[model samples]
Target: MNKSLAASVSPALYSSKTNTKIFTLTSAEHNIEVGNWKIDSTQLGILDTYFIIEQKILHGGKQEGSKIITLTSPNGLTITLSPTRGMSIINVIGQDMRFGWDSPVKEIVNPAFINLESRSGAGWLEGFNEMMVRCGFEWAGHPGLENGEMRTLHGKIGNTPASEVEIEINETAPYEIKIRGLIKESTFKKAELQTLAELSYTPGTHHFTIHDSLTNHADYPRDYQIMYHSNFSKPLLEKDAQFVAPIKEISPFNDYAQKGLSDWSAYLGPTKDFDEMVFNIVPFSKTDGSTIAALHNKDGSKGAAIEFNVKELPYLTLWKNTDTEKQGYVTGIEPGTNYAYAASIEREQGRIRQVKPGKTVHFKIKYSALMNKEAVNKVKKEITDIQGNQKTTIIQKPIAKE
Candidate 1:
């Protein structure tokens, strides 16, 4: 560990063992706050290494009081997660590449400063700058009136703060690091949902996995939805970039998107005032229900891929927003339990998911950063194999619910 990474701490607050170590950064119930701390091989009494975990609190502007946890892996991969914002991953950087787009909103913007119900239900965009953010736990979709109540865009989970956060490390070789966060959304006479979100990363790797378990604490059955909005931009996303996936069926989400059906899988350079387009797709999966999706540059030398279980996330949404660079040029590869329609429309379409009393639902996704041609080719091949002998149906208009 680097000497400059050490922080002054009281031994009584944490364990001094050389094996696995657990740190409780914040727990309101336990009244604990290991404010602004860092740990590495030096503190663990092990061999010198670059692996380190640090937690810091931001103070200033709309980001005041936000808690950020950063994990620096030995393989030159670093990721920053915001526990203050539903444990969303804000940024990811590898030796020669970076994930995530440059959003107009520059600050991490603490949940306290965000108004999810403002702007006629589109206020969620005010604090949206994460590389990966979960959109649901209640309802995630377009803003509209559902049973006389305004359903905000993407729901409130993205703006909800985590009640507790913990960090754990493995004792043996590979030394995997896991960051866990607990977020709960409850309303009297409405619903109660608790989600345990965990992100795991191993040393010497350009990949990480996210595992989320959501349980209904309500006494009666509850309806819920979730979407993993993973966004990317330049380097991995640019002119001539291609989105590779084993498409089983696909259709435009609206009339606007229908105009770009011919070039749906290809991206364009940043254009002034570009109209965003969205495509809804059903991807082909392997016999075991696993699927892969990748976004690669023109020559396929640089890319990013996501592997997931189709049984967990049945639908995929492709979002293309190629507006001017300063106005936010980005694309989203989203997987969710349901489509990106209004909650009421999805319910009418029988796509809304439900959780029985005390029952839990699980979701797992793996993200890999491809920095070389070999890695990019490997993922493309996996997608091709899954697509074998399958005829992709391209519908001309938005899919109509039966």
Candidate 2:
């Protein structure tokens, strides 16, 4: 990563009658608004087309010695990734609108905070406010033996580091930006698992796509688990927001969620000491083989949606923790290859997926910000079409505000 910025020259157009400096930097990662360019006293052809990619090194904290990648497109989309943190997406900004949550800890911390020593993924939970990836080998739950190894919270994939990274920018006909990386987890003489992950965005679209290939190089078949822990907060997850999904059934994971079932699709303002709730969802299969989840803001004017292949990632986990303004006021719409349960439990239930030796599995997921009423309505109609005439059960309203 370059520690200092390099100067760039501006394009110049000199006419016998008029002179103007048209500043333009091509194929550069960072740009400075030096000044506006004018041609023939007319503001006719000024366009910003190139996407920017820059690296920043943090200092004086747990994030010290860490490298973070920031991808910015001309369409007002900004994504930040921490390579040291399993290439986890820490933040996302679309159309000058914040889509993901922000944690109390503003800087990236050490991966040790979520190491094996800290059981139950409590360490990972402490800093769990991002578009994070979870549970690769030994999922965190049940705390039982997994092939003679203990299980802990979700898994350690989010804490794992990437071994290789490649960034590609296409400025030609089809303008797009791509980030590809590899994360590996293995034992000295045991299992070896790797995931090739790619995130891509094209110009003129307010969306991005994630494609992952999980491979096992072990001599024997290896069980693996993964979940896309994508979260939404604040402006996007406002008080009157609604959760829409084409799910066959919704099971409350705990009493709190069971009690709030009536308003399960609705959101509330951040309240003090609000109990965190989890809901397990079984998505309905479609001929197109895709599933979606959307959150429409208070007035239903705008929203955001995520789509994934139900065949590859079968489970969905909806997490709500509107505890407080500063502590946690966000919700997560997670899609996983397996239910986030004890490895032994999922294996016993035959929910665990296996990658045969020398074989690979692939998953494709997309996320888009719905910028208008029509976009929000389009997603709602899709969900309804999938559900058909199945009567969705409606329960009691949420606990009334004091």
Candidate 3:
């Protein structure tokens, strides 16, 4: 929001010498970095902590905008910390899509939104009206889970002292950043960075990859709903927009959409204030095809597509919140690690991935844009070299299903 960069745009970050693990800022834009920190079973003990490089952007300035990025813990396995940029809150004033941290979702037994808690057990979110944020990035269009479900990290694991991580910046690499820390009780190490780049006349786009590993040390089974809560502006999606995925049914939220409850969960609409929603999507069915899915408009113009290593996360969720009176803007495309308390009533019944101590399991998902038919034809030709050797991907669509 602040156009002036001289003072507000200088290098910035949150850091501490004590055993700290996370860093946050909200100056020019919102950014959050999950650093390495010490953890002790003794309860609030030593934690090998990490911090952000100080020279990025000053946080906590007079201006409040939007949260630029958020790096949640890979092991704690809960969506607890989300740094909103300017202002955000839950819709307590109007409609609450039936949410409670203790247990979430209405018709199903699983949770959709991430349930975050502060290190001090402080209530989630800085305020009420603006509650629960991924403290990360919003998507180009509405999220996939909006079709019927939504999700985020929901809980915290491990023990340690000092809730926030400290930071100090360096001038080297210009574009590269660094951090260090370790969660005491966590099974995996933490790595995350948040930085900004000033584009030139061309108006460049942000391109990067998210890398992490999941290791389960617990003796019992460990299931993770691994994913990114791709956010979007509902207003931008509009009424004429449409969604497509690999699955056959939608909205298990509807009491009678499928063959009995088994095949029943599917529906259609600009479902609510958030826009439209599609649930229980299938996978990209072919190598040249996709059981996952893509979205489009009434005319079959430019939209988006989602496909990943099905083993990484088999299901994709399209979520939206139309309660404009309650929440300002909410739309999401969530590729799920597990069914939304859908398909099955018991969480244990799902494919809860388990890792033996000293062993690690890993997975990754790619979220990109969707272009129109003209654009696709351009890229397809480029791929075979009929065109120039540009490697940029055109948003492709999966073949449609009945």
Best by TM-score: 1
Regions of candidate 1 where Cα sits further than 4 Å from its true position: 1-19, 400-402
Per-residue C-alpha lDDT of model 1 across residues 1-402, encoded as one tens digit per residue: 111112213222344346666667777566667779888866766564558889899999999998899998757689999999999999899886888999999999998998888998899999999999999979998888999999899988888888777777776777788888888898999889988889999877899999998989989999999989999998888899999999999999998899999989999999997888899999999988999999999999989999998899999999999999999999999999887888988898888989999999999999999989999999999999999989999999887531
Candidate lDDT scores, in order, read 0.87, 0.69, 0.30
TM-score of each: 0.94, 0.82, 0.45
lDDT value for model 3? 0.30
Write model 3 residue lDDT over 1-402, tens digit each, in one string.
102221232224323323322223323232333322322222323133221122122234221221222222222111112223211112111011111121121111011122333333222222322222222211111112323433222222211111122222222222122221111123333211111211111001111122224444455444344434444432224345544444433433222222223312222233443333334443443443333443443444444444455665565555544334234334446665544332123133453444454455544443333345564333333323321332322112211221
Task: Give all candidate RMSDs, comma-separated.
Answer: 4.5, 9.3, 15.2
Model 3 residue 13 CA deviation in Å: 16
For candidate 2, lDDT tens digit of each residue in 17-77? Answer: 1222222212123322222222211132324554556666667677765557777765657
Ranking by lDDT: 1, 2, 3
Q: Give the worst 10-residue stretch by lDDT in candidate 1.
A: 1-10
Error at 248, model 1, angstroms: 0.8
